[model samples]
Target: MKRIIPFILALLLLAACGAEPVEAEASPPPPMPTASPLPDYIPPMDFEPVSVWQAEHFSGRALLYLGAEEDGVTPFKVYSCFMYEVTDYLDGNMLMGARAFCAEAADSGDFSVDCSNRGLWLEPVLGASALTGKLSVDGDRLTLEYTGCELAAWAEDTPGFEYRLSGGQPVIDSGTGENDSVQYLPTEFKRLPDEYLGRAMYWMPMFEEEASASAESVRGLRVGDTYADIVARFPNPLDIWSRDPRSVSAPDGWYDTFYGSEAGTVFAALFYEGGVPSTVLITCCSYASFQLDGGLNITQLSVSAR
Candidate 1:
């Protein structure tokens, strides 16, 4: 038997693009001109603040500036933080930044604040841990002194910056309070999957006979003896579609045939595909609801209310 030895080979290719060195002497081109500074370099500060705050024991820093009152009267509070892109400021300089406010309250622990962001609430750190008596922004840093301790924070005009705790020798991270540096970044809240509905659902065809039954029962409703006929089965009797978009009162005798008189007749939503009955959404109460998952392909005469 002749055995075949298949030849396999791998090729490696390397390409380099470079300029060849020239021995010919030539005058060097004049040094490229440097760009002149802008005539309107100082853009006026429009401090018409879009937000304000009052906070305490503030650790984390965001797009806005954060601070507390210097008075030793109140506990601690955190107001609001600003949000902005970090790339819009001088490179590596703290020229651009945001600001927030803070207040103190004795009734609730040592830390409390009434600001635009959190409204009115108590912060986590309390008493001596409240961080400062009050806070304010001086140029690029937030300056504050509390409980015989003083600290400064440096933040750029950018959105998310790593804020290191100012003052003292041990060194500390502002938000985490750990000896290890902590970084604060910008983020936004997410939304629910469905609107007003507590759960997710899907619609599909039920048993084949059920759809045929619907098609038959709805035959004489001025629709062809087809999927169109199934849709005509559900008619708008009183035509109450002009009501308000929020509240709706069910019509009398609406559910008499299905749920009986005790079921409290109410209006339900009917869905159709290609002008044919497909799904029915029924509301039992403000919270509880049912979805009839069936199309023209239905069969057995039964309703599973969930």
Candidate 2:
């Protein structure tokens, strides 16, 4: 009787276990492709080929680096920083998905790590800020070597602030499927209206100028002021806008709007001071430039024609 009871319990256990799909077989994933060897020093250094090799085995994320160390070594923490994917659009400033930077080794046992211009680039962050220094990855340490130089991307003025000239660059990933490269989160595009999407670029809804919050004003600052005068008064509001943490990027770089917009022939140049648009207009040039953000430059452009 005891033997019979044990046999019944064993059958019950097998029945509770889910059955596997015997009919359909799972296929194995394809192996990653390998990159070719690098040559001796070249004038315009190319980092793409080496980037491919680094992506294969990179397993860290949101890497943290130590502050400017006299020693070349910078400490890092793993947190998954495969950020920044570039998406192609017709014109103006595009979104900031950005490519992830990767690391690699050279032939003859020489090792080198360089920033990834495309694909899963391991982003190196220090504390809360992204390091702008020349970036590279090796083992658990991420190295940032600053040579004090600004290489104009492709000799064709960088597309816009924080944008790199991706044209004339090597193709790394197809960017489809799980491994294939594609545009930035298409979901944002899907939700946008057709008209808004059709245009290469347009001003995003920033804020309607507030009637108040501006306490004091600089004397002689007014509409129809020369662009030079505005610069003189503020020591370059555009530059201030670029560096200001509170400020957001306009499609064209420094200023908020391009030459002309809803404000008729008058152009708007935004420089924010504590999130308030300065109320001064820059005139005398073909385009009307004015501060759309802050306490000096005027935000108000158009008035009822008398």
| TM-score of every candidate relative to the true structure | 0.17, 0.18
- Highest TM-score: give the candidate number: 2
lDDT by residue for model 1 (43-125), tens: 11222222222222343222221223235443222222221122223222111111223344343223323222321111112
Going through the candidates in the order shown, the clash numbers are 34, 35
Question: Candidate 2: misplaced stretches above 4 Å?
Answer: 1-93, 100-168, 173-306
Candidate 1, position 301, lDDT: 22
Q: Candidate 1: where is the Cα deviation over 4 Å? A: 1-76, 80-102, 105-128, 136-143, 146-164, 167-306
lDDT of 1 at 107: 30
The lDDT, on a scale of 0 to 1, for candidate 1 is 0.25
TM-score, cand. 1:
0.17
